[model samples]
Target chain A: MTRTRKPGISRRSTLALMGAGAVTFAAPWVARAQVKTIKIGMPTILSGRVAQLGTSSRNAVMLEVEKVNAAGGLAGRQIEMVIRDSKGQPQEAARIARELVNTDGCEMLLDGEASSGSFAVHEVARDLGVLCIHTCSEASSLTADPKQHIPNAFRCVRQGIHDSIVGASYAAGIAKTKGLKKWATCSPDYAYGRDTTGEFVLYLKKFAPDVEIISESWPKLFQPDYTEVVTKILQAKPQALYSCLWGGDLTSYIDQANIYAMFTQMEVFAVNMADYTALTVVKNLPKGIHSGDRYIKTFPPTPENAAWGDAYKAKYNEYPTNWSWQNATAVMFLNEAVKKANSTDGKKVAEALTGLTIKCPFGADGTVTMRADDHTLVGYAIGWGTTIPQEPYVPDVKAGDWKTIFELEAEWKKSKGYT
Target chain B: MDLDALASCLASPACLVTQTTSGLIIGMLLFLVAVGLTLIFGVLKVVNFSHGAFYMFGAYFAMTAYQLTGSFALAILAGAAGTAILGLIFERVFMSRVYGRDVLMQLLVCYAFVLIFDDVVRMIWGPEFKSMGMPAAFQVPPLFIAGGVVPPYYLLLIGVALAAAVVLGLGLARSRIGKVIRAAAQNPGMVSALGINTGLIYGGVFALGGMLAGLAGALAAPVRSLTPGMGFSVLIESFIVTVIGGMGSILGALIGALLIGLIRSFGSLGFPLFTEGLMYLFMVIVLVSRPTGLFGKEVA
Candidate 1:
């Protein structure tokens, strides 16, 4: 080979010289490029009955990552995500958080799971000093009181308290108009379920003083056996039922309760009955039942939401769940904060995130604001509507005033001693 | 103690009737699952950890069959037959290897199937929960029971499970092949020496167990929600039933299931928090007195 290349400065030596020159010139650029990338760690529930929660949130994050990367990445560096499955286990969630921070070198993290898992990650964030945005868990206590607040953590998901305010108001209004009382509940037996049910009932009592919670049943989450609960609710003979059962539990309850004609007698107010996935599984979703979407596209029906929904549908071949919007909103806040700070420093970005207002696709007012005090999202469109046989599950999606919610949240926060 | 509570219970005969009916219905469904577990343990000498997963497959299979044929009867047949064939294949391919091996080998095989079946479900059904769509022609409407309405579909589920229990109970005791099975369960070594082809008995019993599980799942699919981990939940309850009733005893499963069902049905009224705990309490009490479980084995 050397002899053949000797006539024309030896082909091997010529190629080697060229390669060496290229390496010499390109080495710095590659190293700089590697340094320019931002890494985010995500711990989520990626298995079991509520697997959809994590999967949807993951999809939403990927969608945002794509959008941001395509538009030249977060802070001029290419975006990278390190996702870990929590398996919906709280300890696993905490372990993954620590691993992502220590082993994976993730500068930022996202913890979007059920309350049990999310709370664990919140503790990790507090201890490890990693910036975290909770994308899904609606437990108000996670970010409510100042004494228990984690400065490193922020939540982009709608708070349970906010939902209660809107849910109770709508329920109270509906109850007043329909003259329905003697409410019962069938909630998942856990913190989220209990809190959501309690908050809704507590606020409902304040709104409609005459409401009586006649029967209450707490079925284990992901437990499909609702026969006993249905029978009890039927026996209680409530004129109306307010439930916090969501996702599969909600679907199971609806189907089981329908079998016993539980719906025929009671005016049902299920907090999360308007979800697309839940609705698809339900055979006979009565037209007049009051329902609300945690993140339904058709309800808002705005051009922005329509576009977002279409895009998400095109990507996933299904409707994006409420958690998807929540995580996407979270991604938006992250992107905006990182851009605003012009730094990937967790503390700086978090400071920028405090009280940041960003355009959201689903809100009625077209924007969502992050409150500085609790680091919770506000300005979310709030209301429940009567179901219809059309595109949007609920037609005339009743809208609520965010200002009123803001005021109530402030008072509640004050009560929590966060103010 | 609480006279007011007693009066309330007495006053609501409808509630009582509804609870009893539902309890029996649920107990019968649990019986279907637990009986399968008992049968498999009886003959195979292998604790099938994947039994719940097999039940889940039956529901999925029935769901698919119903979509294809649009006949509930055909769906039930499909669920049973499909699961039986699946069991046959699984036992032939995997369980056969571990037969005559240590308990650890058998347990490992079952666990491997559990993982495999779980993935198979996620692969086949995806992560979304499926509905077997309740139909209008489901025999009857919510039947008026005292003062409460008993869901019409519930009667169908109860009838199938009860019929299955009776047929299986009689088959295991009265039929010729059934006698061989009982013999094998009692003394597989003796049956093997007696030229009964114990392997065939194991396969048959395993297939039968799978069929019962499938039947329960298919019937439940229309009533209960179908999801990935449902098999796990039902399996937990089935385990409790088997442990309490005696692991390898079919009749014991029936009694155990009904006991748990009644507890769950009425326990919520007295102590909602302790409804689940009561099952364990019963298990602890029974096991304390009789370590081998109620119908597990005769004292040596």
Candidate 2:
């Protein structure tokens, strides 16, 4: 079987021989490859259940690349973004991260937005000595405790603990305003879910002191139903509700709640990433129904957000969403960092990023400050909700429509009291 | 209440409401994908592994239809019809050959279809995530529900699901064809002896299952948003629902859906820390004792 007919192989082998011979003869030309553009790798969840997020992120990054290249290029050379879909799987993320470095020769890695994907790529970046400026995934572990994995990996978004602190405090504040002192939580049953919930409970307890946790329910992530969970929450009769569920889980929760009128029953509902992705997916969710009335509106656009938002709308025929905006801002910051460093060296860029700040189009606080401590951003974290809309752009405007209720809140200040 | 606390509460109401709404939407999408799996397993005596693939195809089909005709309605109709056709083809060309085969073989074949279907999507869609817009008619703002903002589309979703349940239930209970399908489900050999075309009935049932999945994909596109692997998430949860509701029971699917839905909602609030474990916990409990489900009459 290995050598049935050498003559037949040689006759048919001429084509194969020619194929290899041609490539081999062209080897000198391939070796003359010049550095026309700096390649940056962005492995996102492009084609899976969370494919929308990844796609939106990639589009945002690509838009940044286009803007950068158009504006005299970066350092007299065009910046090229090599995007690979993680498919929201860690194994695939690791594999693709390696390929991006080995095959594509990407200097910097931007945006592995999902927690698992980011964690997977972090290890590969450490081995490759590649600078990974994360715009989204904030699993906490990625930034802290080098013993666990890569201490070199840095995230641009707020961590899991920060989210819990913000979400819980908001819920407690609602309870206080309503003269109620009870709180409950519903979160997905996973590491991110559990950690966020636990941290929220701790912080809420620390702040309120008097408010009680009436009940707690942990449903499995991506579980088909939320009805049973809803019943248990209503039975607890908490004054306010807290949820760490993001993405599709948030959408599922809202659908089930509408059926049982749970939305009407709860005094307050606090979702960590609610206005971020969930609101985008379930756009125009009963307007005034949003609890905060903060970051939900698609109008009254800021100057910074105007250009990107307009461009996104023109291309996708939809509003620019949270993940998309975050990703764009992340790439912009990364490009600025590279420009300031004037080199693609990972360590030099990391050094340049320390104490360096850039204004982001998506930020409400005018600028995003990259903290030197863990390389996490210290700038604005915007949260929005549904409100009574006054925007003329939207029609059939009910009494309650989504609006930007909160803007540029100082929620992530490093505390002197933590010790 | 302190003035500072009041101010903070007023400042961040969006966080409170978005969480609640997000959970609700997720549950609704799960029902669409899972209910069909429950039905196929309930009477067919085999887990429909290809259900997710059908769902993935439905979303893709909707995308194709939407591209052809820039109308959400046309896309939805095309999605349903195309999936139903695919289901018919699936039953006639592939599934018909597997009846009475070992459950393992049935599962393996279905699993293989998943690989094939996923690759097909990748080849066609080119590994890109595409979003489908909601119809202008359905983009209405939240109706006044006790002085709260709610997206009117959500109400439409609930209405559609409830109406489907009612129509399906009534048809199954009253229609002559329904009786025949039920009889065929109960005793295929006996129905065949009575001169019924069991093969055709099975194909029709599978097609009906496919239609449900396709409808689910259409309804979900607006809420879940479109992407390549969107169906897999639906598939996993639906499997849990089918297992919990008893393999082949529609009522079980409904009850199980509500159970899972509420569990998810409460889990976000109650045991928020372990919210991800609630469904698996329920699954373990159901499988350990009854092994059929809450509404399941028999354990396979």
Candidate 3:
């Protein structure tokens, strides 16, 4: 009775209606298939003591990606990031990297890990054959060592060797002026810490031969207590100290060292301390401590740099760290490469990235070059300065010369058989 | 067996003295964290895996309190009270159901809380390091002890921690509630049969343990930077302390914490590269030699 009463369509009409309904349902899928988006997977430490490293990196990347999208994206294709937390574990980083490429359909990889996790991601990128831009790791060998080099993986962040040469040159001058002959080192015990500290010391000794490292303490990365290290330094009675501890570790080290008047006794030259993360967090930040400019708005002393820093702070409500700038540079480089290649193919984009020079705010001379040989970033305001108690923490910024950095880096690579 | 290294570390008598003092300060702070963990395990017969999360919360809570009131003492109180309240709620709501369950079930519940607490902290504070500025009183110049410079705050930490230990030791030994807690730990069924509210006793003990951990966190806040997973390192150290001290023994916790602290400080001086491994090595030695721990009794 319902069939008789219902105003049912004829068989042909019903078929046409079903076809129309199917087309309507499939229309968005058709549009979605046509509008392609480039998916870049980021595996970074998003938890643990150095979670800020990941947070800032992700923030900067998102900011750049947002800009690219707002500017109509790369070749009219939107950029999407699939970010994963490695919890600072190397195996987890590898797993997430693989999963992002294999399972999540990510075409490119943005390795946001520190040294340990970054190595793992490097291998994964190699195995997966995805274009990977390392944005956070500063460990020299990740790019400098020919053995570990992958054609698809390039580092956009400052390398430890570059920073060491610049930092040592700057610190050597200060040490000579201050007559700081005796030296002690308290660096985190890891590849980045050990390698960077060693490189800095090597250069420092070369530049200032009178400097003697009487004491060396290699505290495990993220070691909560620094009492023993401080005591060791005091026992040595070094006139100066050098450390590669960054982020919260540096902040904690400074705070604990201050408690024992370590700063008063010895001039500290922590390469990672000039960043706002440590400077702003350090309570009663003792003035006159030397530090490599990690990421101060005023360090590059460029209007563009200051404007970018201001924009980041205004957007995130926090000062950007070295990681923020490095990741921003990475996304910028990636965007440029995509545009230059005119395709999202990993090989093509990677080829395009070779020796790519991008004019960005963080650069030393208004430009940073991706060194053709090592595939590592060559510029981006590498320098050291003394700390002040207030904003523009490291005033009278002294920028490093990239030419000298590159020359020394090449020598270093040759010595290490990495040329 | 590098004599040169040993000699180098021992060359400075003042440094040795300062290291010893620093070890004691570290030990006392660890005792504050471990004592609560051991107490909870001993009384509840459940490993409180979320203890570290509790410690993290304590630090964050103390930071907030310090920001609001600008009083260090009040910050410590706020941290302790906040964590205590959190522990009580966790015990009454979640832990109570898993009391007689399998150990795996109990661990799962506690571990879930750890993850939840970590995420909650990140959500509230954001994933960035936070510093609780040292109070003005503790900012005095370094104190010279045995020709070595020591922070005035280090002495204060030692003093407060020792006071806490003495009060806790006496409370557990002499007070009526302490007697009941000891009795309940030994035989909760018997305590229940004797008309004692075992549930209330368990909750109170858990809360008290959390309070101690919170106290440690609050005290440490001024010295160490705060992170969402900051408690993890402390938690691992506490576990090592508990394992070496015997999981259920208060006195054992004290000795174990001191041993670890001293080892860490001394290890850093002599074998800086292996300092972290040294702790685990010590734990292994302890476990192999004395499974029940330094003061632990064999549970029948």
Candidate 4:
């Protein structure tokens, strides 16, 4: 066997060289770290139909950053946000996160805009050992999947599991009141969609044993065509559709489904149905459509929400979605963590973020507290409402049980083997 | 698996009826898009990768035209004209330079347009989906066709596709210009020797192809929501159509598109999971069984 001293340099020699290089590289970052401004990096989708998701998140982060900086920044240090467009792609997100951490020296990361992108960034965070917060991703696996779990990574948004718990519990009531038992699923064919759909269906059937899921349709996210899906649903004659489709895809589905009289045949219970951006594009949003929103001013119907909405509208010329609240909360959580730990050190802030509570401005019940076990945020303003033609597009906000959400989320986490 | 889908289809008569009509309407639109792709390849021998972009431009142009004029017909014509001009520019500026180049160079040139057109559309329309309100004339009550009710707009779409076929397909097969085109495609050097500018022929073919795509997009705008990447969704199915129907064969495009359109319509009803897969399956089988495609000639 040829002793392959084959490489340009031996592994041990390379390590020695790298060790020296690391020390040299570490000095500048160390010097920069002493600076008062804490740099935060966000990789988000900024183009395509789903651009609103990222744009909303970026605006939200900026809004919070503005407030924090105005009050003399987080822990009396000004926070700077360096944003990059992920294009809703996983690899791009991961690559951008690494560059932000390694190159731009982003001390903290907000890895999200999409669940898939969030997961990719989570792995990057784990490898880089950064105090990272998942801003808008809702996949339960971000915190629950044991293999992917890391101490430094935490999600600041409401998980899909939380949404489903509230959604299913609310759906059971709809099934009973309207006698709409025959169910069908029309979710985007991805983790967030599949997870939310499965959980909602599994729990709905659990809630109402007699409820039957007659059919299902999994169109790819950002799917342009929903004709076949609509026709299939029409053919199935299901009394209702539980959809996880959102943004551009959701708007397209509603418009096309309307053409096929899908709304007439069955009630559409869409989890992400109430974004003002998409609602305005849709020609005819049917009245009395059962739906839920991520974040809207009318949901909490409080003065705080009103002021925030007006301020957000004044800034962006558009109403904020759940992303606005989710992202704002993440940055606010960062502020709380840094203040609590009294340092921006990744490990210390990571430790401090566990069990941290903040006044969630969009919380239906006032505030969300971070769970210590998983470092995942809970008590988001979770709720469902009816879609009506108006400025808010979602009114008559009915709050979901936060205590039930936490309890179910805990039980669900245990089932998934999450600590 | 196909048998399972067939079984599912047989179980629902109304589903079968609605699906068939829906498939044909979709197929007709695919035919419009595919016909242009096939014709361009047939005449110009350039695999125009940005054909879908042309289709997208058509939808946008028609939509804007309709918005400005408040006339559906003018929008349709404007869509056709708008893409034709773009296609002409693509041919004269970029495509003409790459005509004699390697396949890779040609592919790169057209592929560049895909990115360019996408961003351009995004700049103009933003990243949001824009819904085209159904024109009043086509908003008549749905007609009961076979066992299912059909949108009147679908019929109008069929009519537009048929008109395109008559003007394009028949016109290409019958007219003196069509004769020149066919001859030019067969032996461009020979036609050039005979004092005809093959350059004009290539531009015309490219423009016509773009027009057809624009027409399809314009027609589809009412039924389907217009988004920046709407063209990308059409590209895959269009590829499947042109592949099944021999590249550069007009009749081949028509038949292949209908075949795909029907497969999707019925496939979604029968086997929803395999809608896209079925197209790939057919393509693989066609490639293996008949490399020149169903109607294509084996290139020497």
Candidate 5:
């Protein structure tokens, strides 16, 4: 037999290289001996229509974890992520929350995007007295109501109420700019829609006291045809349109309106979640299609959001939407809480999270803190231009798909504003 | 209610044109998805609960093809072929067995496909939503219409759907194979008695329907994000289109699609909340007033 070993390194040398590789890999694990491994749970929509949001959230959390571990591993302990797919279902969320707390031994938890899921996780966290950091669930009642179940629940993002607060101001401003003070309201027939629209109209009344709601239409979410509603709207012919519709509904609506020149006929259109994903879907929209140039996003603090946004796109191949960014902030805050407490105990972490001040790139003033009461963060609202050309940073074919035309940094001057 | 408010909306040509174009795009997409569903239902008499699954397969297949070849057109073609094959297999192995069964059984099998396909998709594509980068040609400026830019693709989609309708319509009337299939659809027993392989005809119709669905999905891939529930949305929308257009009637499908397209365009601006409700209300009214849709055949 021909000897083939002449071209290769000695077995001893190969063994030495293997030994070195093993040691190199084991070095970090050994160094982590002194540090306690802290496990955190994130129950989120990992599948279905809003799966993208969950995936982005997970990607953002992973990035933050990598950053924390790189920087001494969250106060000398390597942080571990115990991610569970919620599939956008509340029941799945509840089951996952229980598993994370009981089976996975997670010390803290991050909330999912959907309100139902968050509420499910919130219920479990309350029962177990575990720290729950909520990012996406915007149902204000979750945080506002004290009598509700979640004792350990804390929201790290702006409530859906901010939709109304910001939407009212934004729409009023648009109306004033275009001299279109009269408006009609159309919204998905749901609590989130109703509340947001009601609040928006109420706030708009403050600015345009004489503004009239010419026509009101409430369509069921996911219903396919909009002919009757369109007929009604055309008959009324309001100068501007206000809608709290988001997700697939908004996307479908935009597609429909563009065909009928509704965008052109409506001077200004206000969608609470318009600029984030809806605008993204209709990227190659007709040049003349303009919804609202300015928006009030519940997440993202500044234009310098490039770092976090870049990190997300690098990993997920998509920009972090408002929910993704918010979730990222919430996860970082959870890690910070563990660091501040110096332990992974949920109660200790919760105590540390309460009124704990931290620098957040996702928030205005480069800083945000968990409120002792209600737990909602005084986060920023990014105003985006749905009609402007897309930016290079965003995933658009060309640079002019969308423009961040305006942003409202939700910050108070320390004592005067949100801390 | 207020003249000033309405006046502002009327004054802005940009908003109006954009909304109209948007509606047309939506309507065109609806037509694409609906026409396929209508065709399958017309010939197979199987309601096709899993029509959305075919759509999903198309999107995922297109995503894969795009990833492998980096060609949008090739990806679309691959997607359509893949879906057609899957549809043929489904017809032969599963759907064909239940051809003479109740419509409920057909729905049940398709529903099972929905679950099975969802998991299969997860295994193949993973749970993350993927985007197929738009072709370079589509990235350019759209046709200028009344000083506003209209997306070239929206016009392309409309053109494609119209061309497809015309071709399919002509083929159904003129082609020998199409004539045979139409004969079978009109009278399956008679076609069988005439020594025609009705089973083959059924499979062929199903495959064609699947291909159409795939084409719709492939076209939508660049325009819409690919997610698990994408097919469900399309399925519902297609059902609405079919019903509105008088179920199983190609002309009815086209008319219904255009009507929906126009409605969505105007309603999103004028009545956002009631957009969906209005659609269903119309369906209800149509069912109540005219059991046979505006273009549907009257029930015996």
Candidate 6:
């Protein structure tokens, strides 16, 4: 002990060493303070048939993020998005969401998954207790069903029930005018497809009692061959066809249907066909195909909407899809929540997000509200119209009434035992 | 359980005719893909897991060619030639090294190429699905056959598949190159000693297989949506066809493809929910009953 004391530094030297150690320990904290960043994890389907969904969502989110960052970020803390591809798999989506928070140090989650992947990500958000905003999944059960609802999660995209109510109302008018009674459906065999199609049929029947679904074909998601499905639809010889097949599936279905001249035979109403992705790609896109206004530069009928669409197209060399606006709105809502809360804490930000309303280009009246009850978006543009091959594909649009949409949505939730 | 519904669907002549034609269309497409896979296995004794990737590349190449030349015929030629060249290079560089190696080693090598080609396709063509609209020649209203409508493009595919079957079957039976290929497959050492370039035969056979797959892809481009992973489903179906018909047998591939196609079409009508499962069920039954397959020969 005596030898050790002799070898050790004197009081002044010991003090100097202690000071150096303290400086070393405090350096990281000082650096962190100087360069603070709030990371948000985005789990999306970036690699399969729905890759465009993720690409467009990321483009929109980044567009908003760039604007916010340019204006000096939220409370001087820059936002860093850590995006991961789920490969269109549900388990992978859940795993990536967990990894984004637990391992990658993300403070929040921006879930850009489709319905199946979204459900898995929802569970992950609940387990991790992180704030999550669903920007793409439209399946009503995600929010309307209390069993699936979580305190920290919200949806910025349109819901299935809302879409069904609006679509049925629009289609009923056409059905009456055209005297088209018999109908058939060919949707992807999945939750979003089945749920939306069922809701649509249920509401279609309610609105137009004369309409009957004579045949239904549920093709596996990303099914390569539509020959059999097209054949079946042709055999049924329905006056009209209603399909919820989306993204590549919808494009493929339309292309294959054209080969058999199926569209010529029936009045096709595809809920997802109006978006530019499908509109621009389908060869000789048959005219007069009725579709929900997924995303169009003109439907919102605002300078802001047009400006945003033009800017996005200019930047990405591709027109934005329904997902792009929803995701951009999600970012806007998140930014507002962060500003209002003035804290990066998940609980505080979440509480601030509850029922938050913000001005957006995609909103029905230049403003959208995050409904307090379901934590889902409302007051956004909703409509159906006929498609043309050229630009301004859907010229005449019929907008959905949010008031009626809400009333019917509540009843739908009640019927599903989700109230 | 719904006997009336089933009966009504089956009872309709138009329905039966349409379904049968649909089956034939699908069967012909499967034959084009399976024939290549079986040929590769027959000569190389390698499963060629990447055959599907070749098919995908064929479609992409054909698409690019069609876009550039606006000639579907030229596109088909470019597709088959491009994929054959790719197959030749792959055979010379990677496949050549694994000749006479362990079965696992061969499979691993082929599987590795599949992954590589998949990524390559995405990098080149991108992940978005694409469509080559049916050529102007086949864009007319569908041809009616026995009260059922058939797309003109599908009829073209059927014609091309039948033509290929006749040419390949006869070529293998009597052509000089075909005799050499068969001889090499039977005894590579003896063929090599007889001054025949067995390596060249192997390369040629592999390229021919790739060409057939490529041709199938080009024909299918109009009807099937083109994606980076589109080949995988067709590959699985082709494998099932080969297994049911007898691996390494062209006749077997044709028969198996038709059976699977008919089963799928009818299965969808009878049991819509289990159409995919029905294919697997048939494959399972075939495997259980005949491990050697309908036309596969004993190795010993």
What is the lDDT of every predicted structure here?
0.83, 0.66, 0.87, 0.83, 0.70, 0.88
* Tens digits of per-residue lDDT for model 4, B137-252: 76455666666756667777887797777788778889999999999989999999999999999998899899999999988787677888789889878988889888988888
Clashes (N, CA, C under 3 Å) per candidate: 1, 87, 0, 0, 48, 0
- Lowest lDDT sum, 10 consecutive residues, model 4 chain A, at A28-37
Writing each residue's lDDT as its tens digit, candidate 4 over A259-293 gives 66667677889888777766777767777777777
Residue pairs in collision within model 4? none
Q: What tens-digit string does per-residue lDDT give for candidate 2 at A129-192? A: 7877776676766665444334345677755655555555665565577766777778887888
Score residue B144 of candidate 1 by CA lDDT. Answer: 90
Off by over 4 Å in 6: A1-35, B1-13, B298-300
DockQ of all candidates, in order? 0.55, 0.14, 0.52, 0.42, 0.14, 0.56
- Model 4: residues >4 Å from true position, as ranges? A1-35, A146-148, B1-13, B136-141, B298-300
- Mind giving the per-residue lDDT tens digits that candidate 3 earns over A118-159? 999999988888899999988888888888888899998887
Candidate 1 residue A67 Cα shift, in angstroms, is 1.6
Per-prediction fnat: 0.55, 0.19, 0.62, 0.49, 0.12, 0.53
lDDT of 1 by residue, B165-262 (tens): 99998998899988999899888899999888887888888898999999988888877778876788889899999999998898899999999898
Q: For residues A190-226, could you state the per-residue lDDT of candidate 5 as single tens digits? A: 7777877776687678767768887788877654445
Candidate 6: pairs in clash: none
Tens digits of lDDT, candidate 1, A1-419: 35432456777889999997888687976656646788899999888767887898999999989999998887788889899888899999999999999998999899877788888888889889999999988888778867558788998887888888988999899889988878988788887888888888988999999999877788887876888778767766889988888877787777787778776788888879777788767766666778766767765768888889789989998888889998999888988998899877899999999999988886668888888888888887667887764567776778876877878877887877777
**Candidate with more favorable, higher DockQ: 2 or 6:** 6
Poorly placed runs, candidate 1 (over 4 Å): A1-35, B1-7, B289-297
Distance from true location, Cα of B216 in model 5, Å: 5.4
